[model samples]
Target: MTKLVLAADHGGFELKEIIKKFLAELGGYAVKDIGAYSAESVDYPEYGHKAAAAVASGQAERGIIFCGTGIGISIAANKTAGIRAANCVSEYMAEMSRSHNDANILALGGRIVEPELAKKIVKIWLDTPFAGGRHERRVKQIG
Candidate 1:
């Protein structure tokens, strides 16, 4: 099974819980959740860095992080070396991020995205394989 790490701030707590259940229903992944734990206020950067570190260290194949707009956490995740975190609001963006950028983390906006749409985006991001061709060169350039 693929190992996936998840992290989210207070703004994203509910969505994170929903995604966790969705992942469980999918039945092919082993998930590790590093959380804000509740809807209480917490800094997004802490969780983002934790998830990024897990993926960058090879403890997990990939990570998912969430914040209010998905921007702040993605920025935090990207601060970690070797972590390509993509903040995606659409399935197309998620597909392209994995296929082209080889994103190690998927960042979502709990406030901006609906639960069903988030599920679709996650499925697409996870299912898409990196199309390594000239894209490989581009991804290397990002390092």
Candidate 2:
């Protein structure tokens, strides 16, 4: 099973739950949810940090973080040295994030994107392989 770490603040709680079930239905994914758990108020940075740490520490293959606009949470996740977190608003962005940036973590906007579109972005980001070659050199420079 693919180990997936998930985290979200109150702004993203509902979308996170939806995606959790979506991943479950897709099968072959073992989701570890470190979350706000409900639609109550909470800080995005804490959850984002937790999810990014999980990926950086090798406890999870990849991570998904969510916030109202996907900006704040992704910023937080990127603060973790080894994590490359991408806040993607479209399928193209998602694909490029993985292929060009080799992002280990994906961030989504709960309020900015619809659930179905977000799902598509997630699938594309997960499916796309890193292009390597020049991209590998560039990604290394990011560290």
Candidate 3:
């Protein structure tokens, strides 16, 4: 099973829960949730850092993080060394993030994306394989 870590701020708490359930229903993934457990105020950086650390440390193969607009949490995740976090609002972006950028972390906007659309993005991201070639050189440059 693939190991996945997830984190979200208060603004993303509900959507995180929904994603958790969706992942469960899909099966084949072992998920670890590093939370902002409730819909109360909480910082995106804390959760983003925790999830990024898990992936960077090899505890998880990938991570997903969330914030209001997805920007803040993605920025926070990207601050960690070895993490390529992509803030994706669409399936095409998700596909490209994984295939071209080799992103290890996906960031989503809880408020901006609908639940169904988010699910589609997640599926596409998970299913897409990194296309190594010229992309490998670019990814290495990022590192």
Which digits, one per residue and each the tens of the lDDT, describe model 3 over residues 1-143? 99999999998888899999999999999999889889999989999899999999999999989889899999999999999999999999999999999999999999999999999999999999999999999999998
Highest lDDT: which candidate? 1
TM-score of each: 0.99, 0.98, 0.99
lDDT of 1 at 5: 98
- Compose the digit string of candidate 1's lDDT tens values, residues 123-142: 99999999999999999999
Question: Whole-model Cα lDDT per candidate?
Answer: 0.96, 0.94, 0.94
Candidate 1, TM-score vs. the true structure?
0.99
lDDT assessment of candidate 3: 0.94
lDDT of 2 at 103: 97
Candidate 3 — which pairs collide? none
